[model samples]
Target: MILRRFFSSSFRLVSSSSSSSSSKLGGGCHRDGFRAVSSMPEPCQSSPLSDDESCDFDWDSLGFGLMPTDYMYIMKCSKDGKFERGQMSRYGNIELSPSAGVLNYGQGLFEGLKAYRKRDGGFRLFRPDQNALRMMTGAERMCMPSPSIEQFVDAVKQITIANRRWVPPLGKGSLYIRPLLIGTGPVLGLAPAPEYTFLIYASPVRNYFKEGSAPLNLYVENEFVRASRGGTGGVKTISNYAPVLKAITRAKSRGFSDVLYLDSVNKRDLEEVSSCNIFLVKGNVISTPATNGTILPGVTRKSIIEIARDRGYEVEERAINMEELFDAHEVFCTGTAVGVAPVGSITCMDRRIEYQTGADTTCQELYSTLVGIQTGTIEDKMGWTVEIS
Candidate 1:
């Protein structure tokens, strides 16, 4: 009822393509059963940056918020069950019915990836293929048709290039790419919608948490459960996120960076933080909660597991008990937005456990290595970085 009322009042119909000039890229054309549109007003001929607009933004102060860019990629599917080719449209809002599946039934999924400005003036995307694959898996579960891996990658690259000026300087920040798929068609009953919309947008972001790469203080949430077995926890569904906002807000109000949720059934094993995957280190062994049904298999978490193993540190994926976490030498979290952030201390129940978070810590080393590879300063021997042409 809340989402229904909000959509009914706020949603606006998208304008026609003929209203503005079109600039097509990456083999996306109107002949592919689709039409491209630029939502810019008259006199703004193209979507890319002009010579005068190149140095206008203050890249240093860009926080992790929605600073709308020049363009977005959008595609749609009809009730007949055929997905049309997508096109680049100027960034703006779109209309939707009050009974849209996403509003009424929570039928939607999304992905997050970043594009970095290389030292040589080129752009690169880190492990986008993983995001593509994960999105396909999420779409299958959410009962929506998803773009193919090639289509997914191409759309991301095209949108990133269209908004290239917003990519920011090398160390300032990265352009965060968000790919969203939602059931848009109106539905009366609790079922899948007849139509869907797939949209990709880019926003310049520095860090998810206000504490950039600094150590984080977390509250172990034994009261609220993040997910349960056979739930939508393993996928990047939009429905899985809103429920955690209450717990995260409550934790932050008390001066904690985020909430570390425990398993729902036992309340002893660690699940994950609100947005990032958690990792614990003891001596030379690095252990994290296994991605059993309830945990999200984070792309950053996967990359770190390989990176740590290649660096000769033993890594294990299993259920991490709270008692073991309190005794660990170091704690950290990994994600696309968080990168690699060390945990300073965790307040579980009434006891507070603190860990060493100095410059010489293992998490600091991993964070540096991961960020260096992402920003193109370190040699990428793992073949994870993809250049955006």
Candidate 2:
């Protein structure tokens, strides 16, 4: 069993905090039930620049990379099988061994979500509870400890409140929240580690574009299997990601943003993307690959299905074979990062199937509606929105 860590040196041992009047991430920066000690134990190395440089990065010229923030949230879990809640601090480098469990065996899981300043000029999280639940599911699958949903959500809020300046205005951009967990126990044996690290950080980001307002051009490889029956496909583990990195890079070189994977067995049915879940629109019905224990149950994917249904669209959760989606009116992917992305074409060995990409379509409607709710422009009748105080 070979495991791999996401970053070469992402671990940072820190002990400190700055001034506490940060923005409200879903964590409710000032909640008293779960107190976030605004204290620091370690000095920060990556000292932050002036507030102008930190928050005034061209939101339009953004790419996916870490822009140093004022702080982060981290907590430790002991080998005695007990853990403690966390607090916020300055964002900087992490300290880990060259042979940490996450480095050797890849025992880890993570989650992605964001905080956005609403039209009313306040911050909000779109169904962050869903992210908390997904993180727990990933934890269970990785054999790692799970942070309580409340604690998890609160940590995010505290960190966001501390870094509120980064939360983009309603139409400009958004603050990206990354809650990461990895096994920290040290050993040479290829086994699950008893200790792990759970940390949540934020990055301000712009939109993830697919192609000229239409669906994406994806290459379907029938030979490579992403996740097997009983494998950790549904779990968002760091290990689950490394295996697909090569495949994804290869696909990108071939003019694709991502690769559409098949089930580990038959190589016929669809699984999901390297990072997001897939969906198909056929007539008035909607379908996505069922969980079947081999796909990540994305928070946005679930919410889209529910929102579409409430708007009177039919949805199906079952095996979605390659043939079915290739013939779909539209194929899109969903996750906290990209929101909902449309796939316009699927490239096989010698052929490519194309569909409508971005105009008046079901996927776009869903995307717009979902974004609206997150930015507080749409009525959140389902009560999924969590407003930060």
Candidate 3:
């Protein structure tokens, strides 16, 4: 099989953390009895930042921006080797060779998840195993090595705990954890890198869109296609995001919240938004684009589907035509960043269609249920949450 190229020279990693706090955060525990992986690195024993409980940061003003945390997790392996151990490092800039695979070509995959501070003074992670599994799939497509599910979850726990003070208070926001797997080794020709690196960082964030909790207004772009058949569109590779920036930028310039893309070959079928999955509601039926080698199967999308089905809604995973938006009673988007966001309007060509955005709408209900389960207010009947610390 012909593997994808992985190399790049100059790239600085960006990550997020939680909010301000005075006391240090506690440890985490995996649902399957997995303990936090301790690093033997001496320097990592103490945080680069102060241990004071008061971080002098405002959690209420927290937006979806990068706020540096105290620590980060990192592991490395060779082309023909397996990842043995990873360690905690001070969160800062990382140097790479100009010919690194991730810099030169583009062999990298990333995953996004969040940690919520429980009401009872603890922390919970929402289906991190799903993110881990998704990262592995992306790694295979990007020709990169990935950490095991256990390792991935363990590292996430470690990173969150290390930056526990940054985690927002209950109902405030959340700690957004970002995991990156990239080819770090130097390479000149178009081939896989000699070495790989798995890194994890975090930031405290509130709403992803500047509109906050308000309904989103989307613009459909027929000229710009997100992904086609047999492409990396199905995976969460780093390269997949850059190409959509143009479309997203254009949409934002037009005062739209984001861009919704159509399939490359069929142009009439809806694929997804720039970074989330789209869904439509009519009566009691909910339909989303099928993830058939094109759409990125979002964790939030999967959870919402299961929740909607349990609530006695007929959920269909099929090709959604552009015309369906006009006939839909309600429309929404799902992703790790956006959550369950109601779509207020969809502008396609000269036609603009609007949908319901009330509290009783399907998207609102799903968002309430999803957030409740994630924050531990509602019972996790699906056993989807893992308590860390």
Show the lowest summed lDDT stretch of 10 residues, model 3. Answer: 21-30
TM-score of every model? 0.87, 0.84, 0.87
Model 2: runs farther than 4 Å from truth? 1-54, 209-214
How well is each residue in 116-196 modelled by candidate 3, as lDDT tens digits?
A: 999766789999999989988887777766777877887788777677778889888999999998887777989877777
lDDT, residue 332, candidate 3: 95
Model 1 regions more than 4 Å off:
1-55, 78-82
CA shift of 128, model 3, Å: 0.5
Worst 10 residues of 2 by lDDT: 22-31
Error of 2 at 320 (Å): 1.6
Q: Write the per-residue lDDT of candidate 1 for residues 208-325, one digit (tens) a residue.
A: 8898767899999988899998999999999889999999999999999999999889899999999999999999999999998789999999999999999899999998889997
Question: Which pairs of residues have clashing backbones in candidate 1?
Answer: none
Q: Which has the greatest lDDT?
A: 3
